[model samples]
Target: MNDEVAQQVVPRTRYHALFVVAILTGSFLLFLVQPMVARMALPRLGGAPAVWNSAMLVYQALLLGGYAYAHWLGRVPVRMQAGIHLAVLAVAAMWLPIGLTAMELPADAEPAFWVPWLFGASIGPLFFAISAQAPLLQRWYSVASGGRDPYALYAASNVGSFGGLIAYPLLVEPGLALRGQSLLWTIGYALVFLLVAGCATLLPRRVGGEPHVAHHSPAPGAGRVLHWVLLAFVPSGLMLATTTFLTTDIVAMPMLWVLPLGLYLLSFSFAFREGEALPAALTRIAPVLLLMFGSVLIAGDQQLAYVNALIGLLLLFLVAVALHSCMYRLRPAPDRLTGFYLAMSVGGALGGVFSGLIAPIVFDWTYEYPLLILAAGMLMPQAFLFDPIARLWRGSAQLLRIKTLAATLAIAVPLYLGLFNPGGLLGPMHEQVAFVGIAAIGLFSVGRRIPYLVALAGGLFLFGGYRAIETSLSGDRTRSYFGVYTVTDMPRERRLAHGTTLHGIQLKGARSRLPTTYYVPGSGVGQAMLAAPQLYGPAARIGVVGLGTGTLACYARPGQHWRFYEIDPAMVDLSRDSGKFSFLRQCAPQAEIIVGDARLRLAQTLPASLDLLALDAFSSDAVPMHLMTTEAFTTYARVLAPDGLLLVHISNRFLALSPVVAAAAARGGWHAARLVYTPSAPEKRDEAAISDWIALSRDPATLARLTGGQWQPLTPQRSFTPWTDDYASVVPVMRALNPSLADD
Candidate 1:
């Protein structure tokens, strides 16, 4: 290996520079392609958060498969390895020039079961091959550069991932149409294929004429593999837990999932950085921070979005750095890099499954979060500064045991009160006091493991588990595809809620159907439904999308036909059952109720039948991406009578939905006006606030009549960017929030 030739193959050389460049480019291209394709599917799949969750599951499964295949090929000779992988890549390209199939989702199928089926049928194989790129290419970089630190390349990989994530919301989505985005991804994939081939050429044919196949060895033992699984499991579940806590209780908005996942990936960059390592001291402080912050996390709804997000992310980073640093310490030598990654891949996949799948089924609530926090506490490595104090604590001597027992009693008394005594022990001020006491005790037990374990148990019992149990015991709770709906029964009425925001409310036994809370008679949907008879004559056909305690059912009049398209079967059952609010039974008992996704069901309706359509289908904070697409508006226009009205509900604490509706109305040649509802009082029974609703129609008369009554123009939001099917932005809406926006 002469100087000039070595330079050609080495880190700073022309060839080596291109090698690094190609790997980073391929990773960027690969990650960018994921969101692009998933966004394309939104128009067809409808904007159920389940759609994105399903797509991510498919990607995780394929990624694990790819890593496993890479591990297997490490046993093959270098040339044969390249040959096989190239052949695999070629086969994957057969399905490319990517676009979703023309197949429609089944009208009757459950979204939980069908979304995975849909994504798997569409692009599983291509994603699997592309997902294998990072690990395999990193190994090749190690081999090509004679085992130089290739770990820095991983930082480049996540940087690309973050770039892709940011680009979807900022650039690719809002800028290009779906068709254009697909073609661009296809071109990038082609470039990646070429790059992989070029990278293969740089691999050493045989090191000193010895086979590269003989360099690696068998898989790790079960104990070592389980250690990897536990380390990976904590961060992954905690990420999802953070998402649930933030969105469900703290804030509900579109695209909030991105931040937690973004931070999770960023932590990996720090964990694996080779040259600049996380110090041992930082690792030691992390557990204490975890114990401290973990209690604060479950300290009831912070409602402080930025503050809570900052604290949650900081806690995740500290724990992730501590745990992943452990994984880094356990990392095998460069020769076993591929096998080491295979174990990690297994752990990553398992963690996702536990958090996404098993947790949802096994626990009625989001219990996986607290459980994972405990797991992180168990796995975190700790050491004590005072050896004598630690020995006295662990020993079973009579006086020492009595002192230990007294310390245990001191922690338990307050913890029991905090956890079991409702507002007594874990009250507002007591939470912090209990946490400080626990942290002080945890300091004494650091290196010994059991003290930290007790502290973690004490913290969870005081913070997370008790509240979770409280929310669980009250039958006021309801879980559906939309999210957790808690039915709050008041003195005069009962309210249907999605998180803290009330969807609909009905008086104890009212005769006339009056719009309650955000659905004031003067609001957008209210005005449209109120004017339905005048616009379409006495026999006007009305279609209400989404059934929330059947509140809209009360607007029906004699000789007027009405229908409701509801997605959740649970909602349908609740609305009709005698125990719940009987708006349908009391108001429009004869109205037809079609079950399934409203957009899909709407496609089956007779053309020009509906004189008025009101879209009120919001599942928690999830903006059904499919409903706001240009094609969806077209469907609404097709079924509606020429002079009909369309009313969309946009009252959300998180997303500014009016701009998206305005964008659709503009694209579809319909006139649109928004009505912002502000109630006279903040706590005056949720049924009294004005619902932020937008009304649109092709007929000037319909729009005029609907706006004739107390309708006010919603101040046009300059910061609100129109969200399209091809691309959407949540930043504008999130930024528009005033500091004083109080959580209900």
Candidate 2:
């Protein structure tokens, strides 16, 4: 009897190990493909960012489909479940070595529609097969192990998810190119298939076509299921909202994209498994943090970027873990695991759609970030930390609720006064002091929902809500496919800003017709446009990629047909309409403006047409990746006359794009020169901000003319990999971004 028991124990242990390994490998590979395929598509899609959001929608839909498929397989026998999954894997293999198919988006294509369609058609089958592995394998383990707890294995799956997310940025991307990453993922997929097959063999056989039965739990009610969905929804939406906030100019690279998502995945592990004590404690204090940081973050442009970034990340981690914990706490029985996960997937998909697709269209700013943060606060499981607090809640609960509302009013009134009472008794310092006091009062009601929300609403209103509400009331903000833009009216200037970066600044009245900001006479594009009549004759056909207030429109002359390629329709409206900036209306009323992605639109224009084409498009933070690639330069080359100049605005806060342009120019067989325009205090009139422009041309005479006076010959960073449609790495650019860091 001892020997029989020992043999049986060995197989059980082996099969459980196989199940664990299968779940981990499948989840890891599943997340690994998401960013990999996105990186591959970056150059083709440009840095519009809506592309990534749209891609996320496709991923969520496939995940829901996979989870539903897994739920359906529950009715089948264990062996047949194994057979069907294996066959599905075999079929999905046809689309392996996963990469996007070669299909260029048409000029008029709606990215919100096309991006999802493209990704769905390309990787949908493979993702569907792999995504089903976690919940499906966990169910198989329950049957095989005589109904052992399968929930703990979910922790393993998320650990694998965290691993995959971190590894893509830290290991796989740095060590290997896209081709290598794709190949490695293929190997990992094969390993997952074998492990899953091994796990299938451990199931106890009931013999010839018999129904394999186990302890089935009772069905969950609609309310209980709805609770699961709502719990999952807040965290998922907040994760995407945080990503959208962080990536815009804070750190506009692919690696930073993983931070919010990586934390979100790791939250599941802690929320589900043995490390419950730590998450529970943090969750209790999460409300306080949300009240303090949530409003200030949404207010934005505080100038303490690093501190805000850290606080923002912390806020996301706390809420995500806490909300996910609610999910783990309310999880249904093992027999109902598939249904539970299906609800989770549904919630996740809905969240993605709201943040990624709907919010950008509906709101003029990232209003979703604050709204989701507030939702996270409301949804997170709450309880008083101390017994005294609990007694207070029970005894004076009704009084406390009313008092909480009054307390919120009191806090809000003082905060409102402080923000608006410029100079004398209350200033910025007084505002900070009021916030400190609010923070202290907020800490007392750590787990009480009403008091906490009062504090939260007050804090939000105090920190940035006052300003945001004021801006909203004025109705000067415009939200677009790219990001939110604030058209701030100043005494001297009317500025167009995307986030913290000023896109264009037009001086009021008569000064508006003058080219200002980065387009002043001393700037490279400024100098090039000044010399256009002599360089390409009086009938100069000029092209500009980015039209910010149509500042360059001031340079247009008679018989000069100027064309502007602007990606955002909002920009076109603001820059051209006589009611807005008036640079285009007053100076170049006849200028033809094309509204679409500059790269795609430029390709559709007449070939060999322009004297000078200035590439100045902005996606708020960084230059559109698609615009600086070799292919993009080739498109520009095709549209220019033999000696026509190509002027690229390379000035950026977070990126060193001079090298990128130099490499692109080198690859396209053109001489290049860079003019780094740094304005002195005296030369700062008419909004002449700092600028950097790269001039590239195939003709020696044109390059000589552009470089003769102030421009210096551009040098390519030989060690830096040139950006192509297939590959571009931001690490080197990041390192060279600062003088101090470059030496290290």
Candidate 3:
């Protein structure tokens, strides 16, 4: 009897281990492919972060379809299901060594619709095949192990997902080019297939074609399924929203995208694991964290950005784990595991659509972030921290109503103070007083859902949401596919901002025509523009890649032919057509404006048609990675005259980009010089901001003209790799991530 028991235990353990390995490999590849394919498509798609968000939507949709297919397969016999899935895997292998399709982007293609079509066509089959493996394999495990619990396997699955996500940015991206990365992923995929095949062999064979293992538990009702979905929905949407809020409004740090997603995936590991201590504790504290940190997030304090970013990530992780734990507790029998995952997938897809696709179009600011926080409050499990607080809430219906009304009244005071006395006219102490009042009220309201929600909403409003609402109501903000743009009227200047990065500033009245900000007369681009007529004559054909307030248009001579390549049409409207700034209208009214991605548009221009070109395109503070690659420089070389000058604006708060430009110059056999211009005390008074720019040219003499006073020869860093369309990683360039490289 002991030997029989021991033999059964040994095979069961081996089978469990096989399924774990299979699920892990499949999930790792599933996430690894996401960033790889997006990187490959950068040259064709342009480098707006929105492009990444759109790609995430496609991934979510495919994941939904994959889960649905897995659920449907459960109706068939277990052994037959395995055969069908293996065949599906074989068919998907046809798309191995994945890459973007050969379809050309049409000139008038809309990114919202076009991006999905391109990515969907490129990796749809492979992603679908890999995505189905986790749920499918877990179901197989239940049957093969004689109905042992399979939910623990889900924890292992998410652990693999988190590994893949972190590895792409840290390991795979820095070490390999696109071709090598694709090959590596292909090898991984082949390994996945073998692992899956091994797991399938352990399944019991029945000649009668018996139905899948049955659970005695009843099927979940419609309401229960919807409850599972809502619990899943808020976290998925909040993940995207938190990412956007951190990078755009808080700080545009490289690899910041990984944190929210990594934590989100890690939360699943903790939520579904067998141990209850960690997730239970996190859920118990989540509501308090949401109330406190959610308010701080909306406060918009730039001075404390890094600290705030950390707090925001903590808030997102806690909320996600807490909500996901609720779903785990309500999980059905192993027989219904695939169905549960299908419903969760549907919620995830819907959440992605709302946050990634719909919210940007509907709200000028990041309203979805706060709104999702409110949704999380409604869904996350809550309990009193102490017994007395619970008794007060559980006493009577009349008492509950009175306490709720009192909480609402207490919250109203801070809201009114924030809205009316935004400048703290009530006193320097007013803001602190309001903060304490709201915190106290919010703490008392805990354990009661209605009162707690009221407190959370009040905190959101009182901190910084009122200001966002004010900006939106004033019609000064506009949101597009790229991002939000705001026009702020300052005392002496009118400024256009993309997120926290100032794009352009036009001084009032007589100075409106002068190039201010980074285009001040002493800047490198300024020196190049001032000397254009002397070098190329008055008929100099100049092309500018970015048209911020059309500031460079002021450098156009009477007979000089000028053109501006701008990606966002809304920028053209704000700078030229809206009469917001007169730089284009007053200086170069007839300058040609070409609206499209700078790289694609420049590729279409006649070779050697321009005497000089300036590359100044930016999405918020981030320069598009594609625009800085070696292949992009080849396009720039093709478009400019043999001796024509190229000016690149390298001024950025978070990245040390001079090395990248220097390396590109070295690889392409071009002479390069960099100028670091710090505005004089007088220039600062006149709105001349400090700027860094690099000038490169094929002819040494052309670059020599600008190398004397402020310009110095650009030295290539031995440690830095020149970016190419096939390979680039921002990890080494980020100032916060690489403190040793900050001074570079």
Cα TM-score per model: 0.88, 0.92, 0.95
Off by over 4 Å in 2: 1-13, 42-50, 102-107, 169-177, 207-215, 247-255, 385-391, 394-430, 736-744
Error of 1 at 701 (Å): 2.1
Query: What lDDT would each prediction earn against the true structure?
Result: 0.72, 0.79, 0.87
- Name the runs in model 3 displaced over 4 angstroms: 1-10, 48-50, 104-114, 207-209, 213-215, 421-426, 737-740
TM-score order of candidates, best first? Answer: 3, 2, 1
lDDT of 1 by residue, 375-480 (tens): 8888877766577866766655686657655666667765655545565655667766666777677666666565567777788777656766776797666565
Q: Write the per-residue lDDT of candidate 2 for residues 34-128, one digit (tens) a residue.
A: 98888777655655556777888788889999999999898788778999999999899898888888887766777688888888878999999
How does model 1 fare in lDDT? 0.72
35-122 per-residue lDDT for model 3 (tens digits): 8999998888876546777788789889998999999998888889999999999998898778888997886666678889999999
Q: After superposition, how far is residue 10 of candidate 1 from its true place, in Å?
A: 4.6
Query: 2 or 3, which is superior by TM-score?
Result: 3
Number of the top-ranking candidate, with TM-score as the measure: 3
